[model samples]
Structure formats: structure tokens, C-alpha cells
Target: MGRSSLLKRIFALNVAAFVLAGLVLAFTPATVSAEIARLEAAVLVLVLAATAAIDFLLLRRALAPLRRLSGLMETVEPLHPGQRLPEEDSSPEEIRRLAVAFNGMLARLEEERRRSVERSLGAQEAERLRVAQELHDGIGQSLTALMLQIDRAARRVPQENPLQGELCGAREAARTLLGEVREVATRLRPEALDDLGLANALEALCARVGDQSGIPVRLSVDPGLPPLSPEAELVVFRIAQEALSNTLRHADASAAELTLAVGDDGTVTLRAADDGRGLGDSVPGAGIQGMHERALLLGGTCQLRTLPAGGTEVALRLRTAEVVA
Candidate 1:
């Protein structure tokens, strides 16, 4: 027979041994014609029953944990760090060991996940800091000096007729640089975010973007929405910031809309839509990925897609466990 069949036969033999032990007690000299036979038969029957019971119990004690453990492994959800192997009070050493192994595996996986998240956030922060430094040092300082030079040149515009056009272009360029510096710094962290409330900060941001990009941005906020925690506020603001930036960068949109609202049922929603060129087949950058990760960390869902007419829209929902700061 095949190996599986052989094992099955062995299992059958073990069961038969237990049955034979019982049969030996029931049909011995105890159950025959002698007057003493009835009493002996009763006693033997009891002994055989006990022997059968002991064998089954011992086998069960040895194999029960393994059987349950097999089922546990199959049911295990490895993706969820919160999930774990079963812990039983009276399981055998082998079973306990299996559970221990599973728990250890989950613990290690969870630690790795935490480190990965931290590393990602750290990278984003570093980028922000880098961009901030770039703007402040390279762009901001240069724009300041250029503005001074433009002012000096403009004063001489009365005398230098030929230099008027050149001065106008220089002045425009200086202003553009100054605006670009502010935009870069805004992307890293808003000036008002730390000092002012979230609502005011968002309003200021939307207005500034609209003015700079030459795209009319409309913000609609529902009065019912409660004040969010700093962390949640920061997340929402950043997502909106990226979405608007994308519209300005890729959509070539003439107009964009932003909305923040909360329902009585405790639902919070953020939406940003634009009427620009729709999404094309292109890989998302680290900025987009960072926003997605931020939403995910808050147990929120983020959706970015091309609208039917044209342009892209972003929608997001935050979970209750999310802390603002």
C-alpha cells in the first residue's frame, strides 16, 4: 500500500487493539457456565473498559494539541499584526511551543512594521527640511537681493529709457522667485499651522495657492464639522496641499474646489476636485505616496482619481482613533 494507506492501516490497528482489550474481558472464562463465571465476567468487563479508556485518553493527551494547532495555523491571518495564535490553559508542551513560535513571529513582524513606518516618515521629514533649507538659503536669499536691485534699477528707469523693458522683466522675475520660495516653504510646513488654528491656516493656504497659481480655488467648509486634533488637521491640510499642487502642476486646471465637512453621525470627509486635464498613465511620486501613507496611518481611506469630465479629485475619510497632533 502507499504511505498514506499504510498510516491509515496503522491507525485502524491501534483502534482494534483497544476493542480487543475490551473483547478479551467480555468473552473469557468469566462469562461461561460456572456459577463463579458471572462475577468474574463482570470484574473482567470493568478492567477491559478501564484499559480501553486509558489508551484513548493517553493518545488524546498526546495528539489533541497538534490537531488544534494545525487548524490554528490555517486560520492564522498573518497580515493583521493584532491577530495571534491560540493560548490554551491545558495544551501540551508541543502545542504551547507552536503558539509561542507564532506569537514571536507576529511580534517580530510588528516591530519591523513600526520601524518601516518611522523610516518612511523620517525620510519625508528630511525631504521637507531639505526643501525648506533650499528655499530659505538659495531661493529666498537670492530673491531678497534681486528685489533690492530691482528697486534700485526702477529708480533709474526715469533716466534710462532703453532699460525700462529690462527692468520690468527683472522685477517680474524677482517677484516670481519670492513667490516660489514661499510656495516651497509652504509645502514643507505652513507658517500659520503651528501658530494659528487649523481652519484659518487652511483658508490662508487656499487663498495663497489661488493667487499664486492663477487658478481660482474655492473652499467650502460645513459648519457642522468639529475642530479636529492637530495630527488629523495636519494630515488633512497636507493632503489638500498636495492635491492642489497636483492640479496646478499637472491638470493645468483653471479652477479647483475644496470641501471639509462632518456629519452628525460622526463621519468626516475631505474632498478636492479640479476641472483640468485628467489623469494620465504615469507613476506616482514620493509626495503622492507620502500622502497615501499618512491617510493609511490614521486608519483613513484616500482615493485619487480622474473625474468623468476632466481633472482629478481626491477624497479621504479619517477614523476616530486618529489623533490630531
Candidate 2:
């Protein structure tokens, strides 16, 4: 029976016990005679008092768990996903039900917290990408021009002189600096994605990822896949980039595959699959989360799962936006 029904029954029983005590006091005429009357009266009072006390104790026992439940609930903070009601194994059925509901609420809260974190991380990456693009378009180009100018000027400086050796060293150092800047800029944002379309950019990214990481990348893009909007292309590029990065950082897999496709109705998909150890629910990296938010923002989904054949697979699917001039 429910706790409320049980308490109702207890209330009815108490009322019946009091009514019976009153009947004994009024209806027993022979027992009410003088000395016998006093003894009966005393017995009736004691019995009634004992029954009332028992009822009070029973009600207290039943309600004690609820009091504890209230205390736990008061301590719970809605914003704090980790805070939860304490387990109450010995609690009454209603108290236990309340505890179960409270824990379920906490679980949902934790899920929301994770999503919020994912969105924040995605925003950060997007900001980094914007900065990278600015550097590539402005600062990086200027540096290249500066290097060329310096090289031309060095050639004009008299040949076969002592300063020529020092100038050669300086020129070499400038070249090194130029390469380093380009590399850093690429790490922040791939210029290929901006200059070239999605397909060609991804091919270059995969080739370099394989060469640098020593993890062979097998890429297969659909030949007939239609061109996607720049926004959609950027998302695909970022997903592939982060997924390959995961393989390099976390996946012990010797190889990975990147697959891209486009549907007639304009659905674009990118998949990065690797044969490496899977990171369970406790993925500490912001990459997976960033990919998820990017997917969500573009009316799509991103999934990270352990491949059935023993690897980690990250996939992104998005509705392609109409291309604009």
C-alpha cells in the first residue's frame, strides 16, 4: 500500500480506539458501583493513555524518514550537478520514491552541465580560428613579403664580403622564422580551407596528418559529392581536423580513415574512424565537445563512439546551407 494509505489507516485505528474507550466508560453500569467503579475508571484511563502513546510512536516511526528527506532536499543545490539526495534504504516507500526522483533530476542536471561546457569550448575554438585566419591573411602575408624584400636587398649587398657571411646567417634565420610562423598559423587555422574548397583542403590535411604523426590516414571522399556552403565546409574541416588530432593524441591506432559524403537533399557528413583505444565517458579533451557544439549549431549532430571492431570513431552530420556569392 502507498504511504499515504498506510497513514490513513493508522488515523482511523486511533479514532476507533478512542471511541471504544468512551463506550466502556459510559455503558458499564454494574462495574461503575462505588469501589469497583474507581478501579474500572483507573483501568480505562490507563488503557486509553497506552493506546494513544502507541499510536503516536507508530506515526513518528513512519514519518521520521520524510523529515530526513526534507533535510537532504534543503541541502541540494540546483546549479550544482554533483549535489544529490542521500540514499535512504531504510526510508519509507514514499521517502524512497522522492529520493529516486531527486537523483533523476540530478542526472539531468549533470547532462545539461556537460552540454554547456561543450558549447563554451566550441566558442573558444571558433575564436582561435578567427584569430588564426586574421594572422594568415594579414600578418603571415606581410612576413612573406618582408622575407622576399630582405633576400633581394641581401643580394644587392656586395658579394664575397665579410658581412656577406653574417647576412647569409641572418637570411637563414629569417627563413626559419617564416616557416615557424606558417606552421603555427596552420596549427591554429588551415589556410587551405579558406583558399581551397572543402575536398582539396581535407586531402592536404590528411596527407600532412599522416606524414607528421606517423599514423597512416586513409581518405575516401565521394566523387559526386556536391559543393557545400562555406560555413558547412568549415564545420567539416574542423571535425576532420579534431578527429585526426584525437587519433594522434589518444588513439593508439596505427591508421585512420576520413570519409565525406553529400546527399541529394543537401546532407553533408564527415567521418573519422581510427583503430585505437577508446576513451570512455571520461574524455578530458575539449576537442570532442567542440565538435559536438559545432554540429549542433549547424542543425546537425556529432557522435563519438568506440568502433565495434576496437577503435574510436567521430562522425559529424549537418544540413548543408545554400551557397552564397
**RMSD in Å for candidate 2, one decimal?**
8.5
Cα lDDT tens digits, model 1, 162-256, are: 78778888888889879878777866877677778677787987898898888889998887677788768878888988888888888989999
Supply the TM-score for candidate 2.
Answer: 0.56
Q: Give the whole-model CA lDDT for all candidates, comma-separated.
A: 0.75, 0.75
Worst 10 residues of 2 by lDDT: 1-10
Which residue runs of candidate 1 sit more than 4 Å off their true CA positions?
Answer: 1-104, 153-160, 204-218, 222-229, 244-257, 263-268, 272-288, 299-315
Cand. 2 Cα-lDDT: 0.75
Tens digits of per-residue lDDT, candidate 2, 51-155, equal 777778767766777787888888885433456786656555566778899889878766776577557756776888888777777777877787787788778
Pairs in clash, predicted candidate 1: 229-324, 230-324, 230-325, 231-324, 231-325, 232-324
